[model samples]
Target chain A: MINKESVIHTRNLSRSFGEILAVDRLSLAISRGEVFGLLGPNGAGKTTTVRLLAALLQPSSGEASIAGYQVGIDDQEIRRKIGLLPEAPGLYDGLTAEQNLAFYGAMYGVEEISQQIKRYLELLGLWNRRHEPVGTFSKGMRQKLAIARALLHEPEVLFLDEPTSSLDPQAARLVREFISDLKGKGRTIILCTHNLEEADRLCDRVAVLNGHLLALDSPIELRRRIFGRKVVFHLSATKTEFEPILLEFDFVNHVEQIENKIVVAVDDPDTHNPVLIRALVEAGAEIRFVGELRRRLEDVYLELMQASEGIINGTN
Target chain B: MERIKAIIIKEWREVFKNRFVFFTVSFLPLMITALPLVILFFTGRSEDFAGVTTADLPPQFSSLCSGLDGAECMLYFIVTQFILLFMMVPVIIPMTIASYSIVGEKTTRTLEPLLATPVSTLEILVGKGLAGVIPAVVATWVGYLLYAAGAHIIVSNPHVVNKLFDPLWMTAIFVVGPLLSLMGVSIAVMISSRVNDPRVAEQISGIFVLPVVGIFLGQTTGLILVNQEFILWMAGVLVVLDSILFYFAVQIFQRETILSRWK
Candidate 1:
């Protein structure tokens, strides 16, 4: 059990290797039970940030703490508090699935070590193949074992670096579901990923790490900020007779009839959606649902990139 | 201490897990030391080993084999084993310990997680050295036991070999053997930590063997031999050299520098 009071703090953390600045003066706070997504394009210092947090690399300047222990000063304490699943799964290739877990569990001093190994072996549905060496396991199985190793010690904070990078759609869904279940329990998670769709589904708030943080907000908040608010409705309707009724609503900025339902892109949908809903009711249309719909993360992210490029062009 | 025990167990288990490594650590020294003697026993007529070709051997070596019978000839073989294999094994000892300790972690990607653990670098070194050493020493004793058995059956005399089991070789085997291994392992570890490529570390660590091999040949060539006075002088030289190497190895093994370069 982690103390809810524990705060992941970085005062002015920085890391450099001679001429290369890997991470620079990153200061941020992550609280218990919040899933904070870290996003960046390739070579944008995301992995370096994860390594520093894991204390696998020492900071060149300033301090950061996990569970209130300073980066270099009390690094082991931070390590103990956080569960790290690195980008490439760090597992002993020749060892069996069980043996791989044992190695990590021993490192963490996890009590009842063998018992925990058994638990993960069963939990990940790898029990039957427990005796088989990990080298022979599929990529997805190996990744699940990596996640099991990370979670074996039941760490308070979890740092996941591209946890589902190599999985198939089914395997990816399973991992996303697991992450979602974990967030409900209030574990502080820092998910580092390039998969925009996956990040939108799993992250409570995401930091758009484009050279610097372009935006940080819940997925919905970010979409509305970048692409404006819109609503789409799919209705089981008296289709031809009810089609004309949606045009008279004063709150709707625009409406389009595609197939059976009306699509409305509204400026103030909070107040406008209700008026549309009532108009449908008065029009004798049996509306199944009415809700605000916005740009999927795919569109929002591309728009963000375009906006950032535009900003750079105008300034230059 | 618990962490030390865990790491040591981990190292031993890993060593045992690999058949090639386990066989090398558990049986190679014994084979290298005893297999030649076994061939000599099966094919050698008593006269071949015991004849003491006075024309070929120096007076000192000839005189030491006065009886030149089974046990007596075996005693001479034991002394030879000490001079050659004793030194050669230590050379590889450092390579195995260092490469396995550092490179194995890098291969497994356990290096980062291990460095993060509560265990300090020195403690990890102790675990590594012990893992390399205990097996090496056990293999040495196994070799000695095989020699004892072969000599008892093959030799005409039993007491002569027993008499040559003096305090010096015993001390060399028990005390100095592990010390030399520790020195080698420490140096190898420093190299391994600096170099990410295991093969490169192993190759670089192979440089440590040159001095030992040079001394072994110098002795065989009659340029040097460990008589009482000479042994005392060499002891003094070795102590000074080992101290310097020890200090240098520790100084070069900088954790921060290595981690930054791990690609």
Candidate 2:
């Protein structure tokens, strides 16, 4: 179901380069004020998808719209409504930071251009070095200046390809925080990144792609859907008898015993864990500690990618 | 229009910082202006030409240097040979700059972001074309002005100076100079859009100057005499060629082809 409030919408968007299909017939919608992440490995069409939706490349056989403007047909109107920070930070190294922003600002038809430039530069902590040519700037500094350039026009939709790909922890954290701040302001951002942890934190939802949509959902939901809720119960002793006690409950889907612990998979752990604990206690099982197994997004991503690879290899 | 202006300003800012571009635009014109004046200065002061008559000159000079004495006619003929060199100024300087424009942007990875903007392809081509043409045209005009000033100061015969400012040479400088610069810029831009290396683009663009040099050779060898009719006809041919090249440039510089194929 497509949300009525979706700011970005696409249906069967596909793009191909001669013999290779960069982006398949992928369809997805991004709602307003959502931070959506596009995650995929090398040659997975993450960048091509962004380019297609940004109207930088025409779709081979699909349709997309940004802020009510159709892609390809209304490319200029869409371009006017969006800001894009390409993968390279693509700045003029010979020009000063201020001059660079001023150039982009003018291209976007931004009014009060100086004020807009000052605001973004100061926000990115680059105002002090605004006069310096970008050639002298460090990698992190150039990335920040590129970010400032992307946000100078206060675009309605921003497509950032690897926003924090090659930055120090501090710089990456600064960018992450800035993205959070933008989220708070109700700005819609489509982020493309290889850092799954970053995507898990920043994205309201993420789409994992390998030339086609492999999976799309919130991180936690995907975790739950892929590797259902597993609750681990630690006890003084693990006996074969505890397994049957957990199996006694119809709510428990599976149970495993590992030496001194019991791992149980349930549909709703919050509602079913207590009943299983009571049954285990009655079975003379001493529960020392009971905790849910925490799964990282990395695990989910690896599982999905491996499954997709198996399907592609005809081994699934 | 404003977006085009922004691109032009940005291009000028970047172009001015290139030392090679600065040297080409500044020094080449100065050299072209001063070289002819120096030769005229020496020819006007030479003692060997004191008694030489038009009878001593080649047959081709009989009709071209009509009212002048032998020395004056010799100086006028020598100065006329530099007219084609003056035309080469606009062609050479803009080629140096325009050859680097698109290919340089691709090398630096700035083309994608610039193309992502609301500005159209035509605006970018126009902006870049004007950026190259303006400087080359300005340099040629300034060089011509200084040459004229120095000629009037150095020549004793007013007729020689008058002949230097004839309709043929004036049209060559004022009219054909800009059109040739535009043609050079269009060809360079077209080549720049396809090539990966700016040096390769420049090297290939250098082949274009041969035709103009061929004309210069023909004129100097007395095989073809340039006059008002020839200047106007050349301008007409350049106008047609500029339009065709500009159209092809726009066709070749497609955003999809550039972002995908120009690796």
Candidate 3:
């Protein structure tokens, strides 16, 4: 059943350019206020998907909607209800920051524009520089201004594509925090990015795409489902002595002794960790620390890429 | 409707704020108009002009020089003929501004955000078209007024003012100038949307001046005798041409198409 709170919904959406299929049969349902990330590599149709949903591109097939408005039929209405920050900030460099925001505010027909512009400029920490020409602003500052431009009308849904591609660490963090705050305001967001860490940290559910949907789930769920559970135990004594003893437990899927740490792969660490700990202690092995290993999303991403590659090469 | 107005205002602001566009839009009209007045001034002053009489002038110019001597007749002929070339001012200025408008947005990567708004394609087209046409038309009229004043002062003849501000000249400046400006803007809009580079779009739309020059050529070569009726007919043809170009411009302006095919 489609959730009533779903703000973005697509049914087998596809777009093609000449002979190239940029996006193919992508289906998704993103709930209101959810920060849904479309994760992919370069040329993986992430940008294409964002354009389609934003009504900047027409799908070659299927259907999509924003706030229950169909993409093609209700394009203007959809546009009115959505804010889009394209890959480039795309600021009118000749205009001052205030002018740019005001232009967009009027373009979106937002009433009380002066107050809206003031509110957004202040919220984005750009009020002091509002009078400065955007031509003089740095990439990050232009991006923040673009964000404020997108939000000036207070759209219900926001789309950001590669929001922090070229920013310094400090600027990237500021943008991330701003996006997090926007999410807190209950505005549904669709973030398209190649930055795996940003996606892992910010997305409630990420759709891994490569011309087609590969995997769709939370980061932790993807890691656990694809690579299983792994726990590393720091032992006071040689790990070799504890490895074989710990391996004897039927619940322990696999064990490896590396220096002072015994790494164990298990079906369910939450269920078997206590039993494994008692067995190790009863067997005269001193365990200092036992915790689930933090699996990097990069690993799962790479693993999925490799699997997709194999499938492409007909060797999967 | 408000969206179109906003876009027009934004475009006007951008045109004024851009130093290069500002300089050209401000000076080109004065320069084009003032050149003819200067020539008329120098010719009126030269004493050697006694050798050439009104009979030596083209038969088509005979009516304009009826009350004048050799120098004054020569001045009248030059002023009237060169004013046709002044038509190039409106064509170039508006076309220059409109040519760069869309393609410049594309280069700066600003078109996406503008297109992402709720504004219709026709609104964007009209806003930008008017942005280009309004300034060009204003400049042309102001330049014509200045030229008329300068001619009246420099030539030291009240009839010179009478000849320059004739009903025909008024029709050309008021009717032909705006329609030609709209045509230039329409061409620029059509070409700019297709081209990625602003320079290329400007160059292609620069072809607009050729037809005005063509009329000048016809008048110069005696292929067509220039008169009030000729000017009125030209304005009529321009009205039809402006309408055709406008229809195609709006039809060709697909927001999604530009966003998709843009490089």
* lDDT for B258 (candidate 1): 63
Put down candidate 1 lDDT per residue, B88-155, tens digits, no spaces. Answer: 57557556755766777776676655665555666676677677766666656566656555655655
lDDT of 3 by residue, A1-316 (tens): 2134888999999999999999999999999888889987899999999999999889999999999899989999999999999999998888999999888888898999999989988988999999999999998899999999889888999999999999999999999999988877788889998888988898888899999999999899999989899999888866347777887889888898888888899989889999888988897778899889888888888899999999999999
Query: In lDDT terms, how accurate is model 2?
Result: 0.88
Docking quality (DockQ) of candidate 2:
0.84
lDDT string, candidate 2, A1-316, tens digits: 2234999999999999999999999999899888899999999999999999888899999899999999989999998888888999999999999999999998889999999999998998999999999999988899889988888888888899998888999988898888888887777899999999999998889999999999999999999999999999999965545787678788889999988888999999999888988898888888999999879989999999999999999999
Total clashes in model 3, counting residue pairs 3 or more apart in sequence or in different chains: 0
DockQ of each: 0.36, 0.84, 0.78
Ranking by DockQ: 2, 3, 1
Task: Work out how many backbone clashes candidate 1 has.
Answer: 2
Better of 1 and 2 by TM-score: 2
Give model 1's docking category: acceptable
Q: Where in model 2 is the C-alpha error above 4 Å?
A: A1-4, A236-241, A284-289, B44-48, B51-70
Interface RMSD of each: 2.5, 0.8, 1.0
Candidate with the larger lDDT of 1 and 2: 2
Relative to the unseen true structure, what is the Cα RMSD of model 3? 2.7
Looking at chain B only, the TM-scores across the models are: 0.79, 0.93, 0.90
Candidates 1 and 3 compared by lDDT, better number: 3
The true-versus-predicted C-alpha distance at residue A111 of model 2, in Å, is: 0.8
